[model samples]
Target: RVRNAERCARFATRSSTRVKHEGAVSTVQVSVLLPECSSAPSHLDSVLNNFSSFYLIKKLPVYELLDRHFLETAVYHGAVFGLSYRTRIDEDNCVALMPNGHLTLSLDKDSFEILGFEGKPSRFKHRTATRFVVSVDLTDSSMAPGRRSYLRLLTSLKSRLQLQTDFLLSHHPGGGASIQPLLSRCDWSQHRPEVNCRVLTNLPCPAPLSCDPHSFLEWLGAVDAGISCENSSSSFLSSFVCPEPNTMHRHALSVSVSGLLLPHDIHRLLQELRRYVEQPRLASWVSMTVRGFADSPVSCSNHEHGFLRGGENFYTLMMFHDHTYQLHLAMGAHDVCPP
Candidate 1:
């Protein structure tokens, strides 16, 4: 999981692609941890401040996404990340717009019946088959504006289902320009990714690379949540403690961004993190965790995502001072393996 500093660029390139894939589906939150650091550098702060802004369309009609002009200008130009806001994966119907111009609908049996689209049953484990997944590739020849499949979906959504929900949407390469046509038609508001920073003093932490995966993640999670890890194993309130061979860092920095985040923004952040490490510094490592939208219809690389239990889909990347890196990708029981 670790690579030499010399191969950091190559490694970063590969990893950035992976993160982009995940982000393309939907990213709600990204958290970064810098142990033994008191403050963020100017460049790093700039990257954090400049994360892309996304739009929230209030009660956007599902068929509007299929509009000929909107598709040509935005979705086709580059990846457009869209998700049905406030929709719960386990209960309510959900929609996802993938980077490859695919529109996915996770619907319950009744909803699927009403929508009347050709789709497969849900892949996640369920006591009974009560859900279905309808995926339409907008770029397919058959889905061309006047084609049968295109009209079929357009009719189903526009007339039959009349699906309208608050939508969170963002695009790369084109940003607002590409999506302007779509946004102009809806009641929408633009929002920048919200950034939060925290400085911790005398924090107990384990050596990230040397600690066991489970233990280190547990410790890191505790730290991120501002939980006290100074507990005995037998303590009833909380048994969590810094792993052995740990050191007390005089100070550490934690920064997080929450919103409809894009891959381009994340890649830039990673580059800044690498740049931070390349400089002469006391900290030997930094960690970043990107969490996908729990209700997304797809996870990394367009894998079918479900919420059978936890609905967890996320990855944690740990970069060391030597340019070596470790990546841990995980998904919930309802999803396939992460890429």
Candidate 2:
């Protein structure tokens, strides 16, 4: 039976890829039957068992003809693999697996014809048969969007066809990990469900949820500012921290700022942030976003068009200072003083 199955498989292989794409648009219908009992494994199983049995019967001539017919049509359509038969048999029951995993027992061949036979066994008086239909399509990465849409169609069909199970596995033919990030930073919120954020056993951080980017940064900054005083360095920094680091740093600052002003302003704000941490004169930098500046008393005149004109404009200004420190390489120590 296995040898016959292999022969049948070889015969069917020719049309598998083509049928997978074109589907059973014009195909033969294959049918199989088993005992009529409620305890029957399933109709699909019966159909598969019947096909396997026929293949094992040394019915090479019929199998080869059917295989050739399917392959010829599939090749005409430029298919890569042809549909092959899959079946499993237990002591008293048998089951068949189909490419599409449909629950029916009628297979539609490429010629839009049905094939199979009916049989009854005494041990398993009750039996059922399941049917499967398939089609093939091209595999081109350039058609990724189209291929994705096709896969989605398959998913829908699996539900509508009432298949027992179906899943999609994608692969690159050349076999290398594609380094495109699985999920984009901006789209993380949207694709979060697809992300596997499970905690592994014996991990350094068992309560991993608490170690996200925001919390980690906050923890680091707090420790740097001496909020965590368990360490000796934290205690020293807390005691020696200067109150007017911002003012002293601002006096010594020189910046060559040129870019989209928005980005330049952002860069300046970042520099101000550095001064808050390193300068003896600045303790903190305040960041703010102001809108509707035309109504403010300190509004500057727009060169191309005055504020009173119809055109709309906006500006972002960032103010910051500089911090100068002396490095003592021998002692690995530094001195923070106003620039």
Candidate 3:
């Protein structure tokens, strides 16, 4: 829960910033310096519509997810993506429903022992096995309903530990209908990812094409945080300022979407963003920033993900009107660097 708390705190800080901006949006980490260009905005709004939506299932038994009827309809199809809600990998027995038909359990020592499933020590943070990772392939031939191994797992989850959590669930093309069987048995609420946009006038922006990544990111954060670079030397609250040799934009656009975001929708957004940059306009570039789930058991490219200092995992993409672009990816010390 520590990871979740820390994430919440960060989000709270973001909330304060939003109030300062009167509800305008601030993306996690990224900024593009618009160079003089010609382009018209078209269908840019459709990108927001394509983003995947997710649902929250309250107090759901972990075992219930193993229902044969549900598995056959969703999991076996390799379209489901799920993870326990409000769970922090650094301090909780988290569950993950992977798209590849695997149910991953990252459990503590006692819970791992009770589950009775074969698993290896977690390679996150600690070298020794303070925690463990058990991944069961629901798609394996031996995992068919009523099989010995399947029954063993069923009993472990249903009768032993009785693991239950608020699960964040989503499926590809089928979406909600794909997992209706499971949702029918539990209390649930559906939610669409929320989007916020802010336009900054007389904004100071750095030349991303030339600025060092570190400094660029810092400037991006300053803008997102609404920190005043106009502070006088004697000002006490903050003395932050835009990077040197920056140019002023009469207007700069910042757009962000937050929630149980999916990679497919993000890809489509990128496609739309590219279209946005290709049109004739006055901005030099456009960008999209993505923030990963704090409680996720996996990060970009499906690598094992863990939380250390709030699990700082995110990336920024800047598309230039010149047709050249740069992608900057980062996952702080706790995760395998993005692929």
Candidate 4:
């Protein structure tokens, strides 16, 4: 869907809010395209370089996430993004701590029974129902320290199940300071977001708004991967070609950032991109794409995520020079509707 970004002041604010809501949740990678630029501005570079660092806690106990200090300092005060590393959602038990202070667990029937928590069968269950989902709001009154539900879950994870796994965690507003207490208790390492850039020369491109959605995404993916689309149907490898009514851009910039990205940082990057496009420039449009983690148990909010044929969930935002934008949110066949 496309919206005139500056048609009205109030509507612009609402659109900005929607962008933050839809594009920021559990992003695994972000890619940006500037069709006519050879280099990025220093300020933009700074923003991209300064994305918050995240921590990897090795073999951390699942019950530790409910620590009073960690919750009071990080989860309650600001958003904290966490996920179990190297754990497959469909096979092994997977855990996710969302920004809204909710802890979600996707478990098999055996593990779910062992955990002994109140939960519902997974919506993705087939005829037999082998999976279950347990979601708990950490900020709820019943989850407060010394409460009945809080103690029961803590004991269940600590004494009964004793679940432990490698965890990836990060917090906004406080960053390392907020999560240091949790890190101090376990073996951990901190790392920054990885950034990559490529300069394309004489690249074929289609009209941003006029091209078909699937075809445009195909062309964009080819460009991002440096694939040659000059094949014919009779060719053996790939019969991909740039869509018709396309132009050859003399220079274009492709930049990407990958990590356990937070929504706040992405929102800042969008503001910078908007500022960059608003200035007098040769290119009339630019595009940003965000991809969610493939194995995540939840996509936008609490929407269940599953892998049927390569569990893909993502969105692309195309901002034009005239303060208008197009948003395309997509999911795999087995996934639920995106927010």
RMSD of each: 5.6, 32.6, 8.2, 5.3
lDDT score, candidate 3, position 65: 82
List, residue by residue over 115-224, the lDDT tens digit for candidate 2.
22222121111234232222222223321333554344334433433222111111112211221122121121110001111111211111112233333223323322
In the range 194-301, model 4's lDDT, one tens digit per residue, is 999999888888987668777887787788788988788789888888988889899999999999898888988998998998898888888888888888888865
Each model's lDDT: 0.82, 0.21, 0.70, 0.83
Instruction: Judging by lDDT, tell me the better candidate of 2 and 3.
Output: 3
The true-versus-predicted C-alpha distance at residue 282 of model 1, in Å, is 1.7
TM-score of each: 0.91, 0.15, 0.84, 0.92
Question: Which regions in candidate 2 have their CA more than 4 angstroms from the true location?
Answer: 1-130, 138-155, 158-174, 179-339
lDDT tens digits, residues 20-45, model 1?
A: 32353588899999987888989999
**Each candidate: how many clashes?**
0, 51, 8, 0
Pairs in steric clash, model 1? none
Structure candidate 3, residue pairs in collision: 34-284, 35-284, 37-281, 38-280, 38-281, 39-279, 39-280, 39-281
Total colliding residue pairs, candidate 2 = 51
Candidate 3: worst 10 consecutive residues by lDDT? 17-26
| Candidate No. with top TM-score | 4
Better of 1 and 2 by TM-score: 1
Which candidate do you rate higher for TM-score, 2 or 4?
4
Q: lDDT (0-100) at residue 71 of candidate 2?
A: 25
Residue 28's lDDT in candidate 4? 82
